[model samples]
Target: MKILIVEDEPELLKVMSVFLEREQYVVERATDYASGLSKIANYTYDCILLDVMLPGGSGISLLRALRDMGKLDSVIVVSAKDAVEDKVQGLELGADDYLAKPFHLSELLARIKTVIRRNNQHREQALEFKNVKLFPEDRKLLVNELEVCLNRKEYDLFYYFMIRPGKLVPKTALAEAVWGDSADQADSLDFIYSQIKNLRKKLKDSHAEIDFQAVYGIGYKLM
Candidate 1:
């Protein structure tokens, strides 16, 4: 998962980045309001950790701007101002959660997980697609009460397909999501095809009827 942190305090920002990265999340940081807003405008994050006091402007203004632009679902206000009204105002503006300045990194991580859980409508800790059950948190895939062992890319490919069931997914899209940012630099998408082939064979061997349909001109659809 990807997260954006908007904080001005260098030490706190660094600590948070390290903590979140340790938890296996992609972390991006912005020191002030302008940079934060620019990042929000450009990238999609699972959640945002926004500091109220910024170098260029107030976090409340940033929250307001996010709301104005329909990004209310992606922000959580983190600030030193712990007034009752400040909390209330931030909540009313659609911040998913609020954490005071002095907080445990664990607590912040938990909040991010909670926000992501709340946003995911069709997924639980155990992701269910048709008859297949994928425990993303546990990296386990089960079909018809049977456990199926999968390699990292195989698991990721399965999870991605479950996340967007019934929709055709392109080979490049799968590569970019499952692989690192360097997926764009790959010489061929043959590796993706190979992964798909292995994943499908495993599912079929398990008696799972999940279909990875090739769309000919487009991509594969998880049916």
Candidate 2:
């Protein structure tokens, strides 16, 4: 899972990042509202940890902005303000969950899990595409009930493909989605081709009833 932590408190931010990383989450940090907003604009996250107070702007305003952008289901409010009014406002403004200060980290983790479980459209931890199953939490792929070990890039390729089943994904789009800004200077498309090749091999080996096709003058399509 990917989580964005938008807390200005240095100590608390570090602690939260350490704990969540240990739990196998890809944790990203943003110390202030603008930084957090940039992250929200650029990347897709499974969840966001937002603070009410920040150096430049209030978390409430940030949440409101995200809500306007139709991102309410992806945010959790974490604040030191424990007032009833604050909690009500956050919930009303579209926070999935609220965690007050001085709470246990374990409690926060559990709350994250609960919010994700409630918000998940798939109804489970595993996402299904035809005959393949991709488990986001475990980072595992299974076909016909048999596990298929995959390399890092191969796993990422299949994950994106499954999420966009039957869709044509351009090589540049996939490169940018996976490598972010670094893909701007990518000299060759060989790396992406190699990963796709490996992913196709693994799926076929596992007896997956899916086909990865190269579209002429385009990119790839999972069918």
The CA lDDT at 17 in model 2 is 91
Candidate 1 local distance difference test against the native: 0.80
User: What lDDT would candidate 2 get against the real structure?
Assistant: 0.80
Over the stretch 113-138, how does candidate 2's per-residue lDDT look in tens digits? 88877887765678888888889767
Show how many residue pairs clash in every candidate, following the order shown.
0, 0
lDDT of each model, Cα atoms only?
0.80, 0.80
- TM-score for each predicted model, relative to the true structure: 0.78, 0.81
Per-residue lDDT for 46-107 in model 1, tens only? Answer: 78898888998988888898888876456788877556676788899999888886998888
Model 2, runs deviating above 4 Å: 151-157, 170-191, 215-219
Clashing pairs in 1: none
In candidate 2, the residue pairs with backbone N, CA or C atoms under 3 Å apart (3 or more residues apart, or in different chains) clash, namely: none
- Model 2, residue 57: distance off in Å is 0.7
Clashes of 1: 0
lDDT, residue 45, model 1: 67
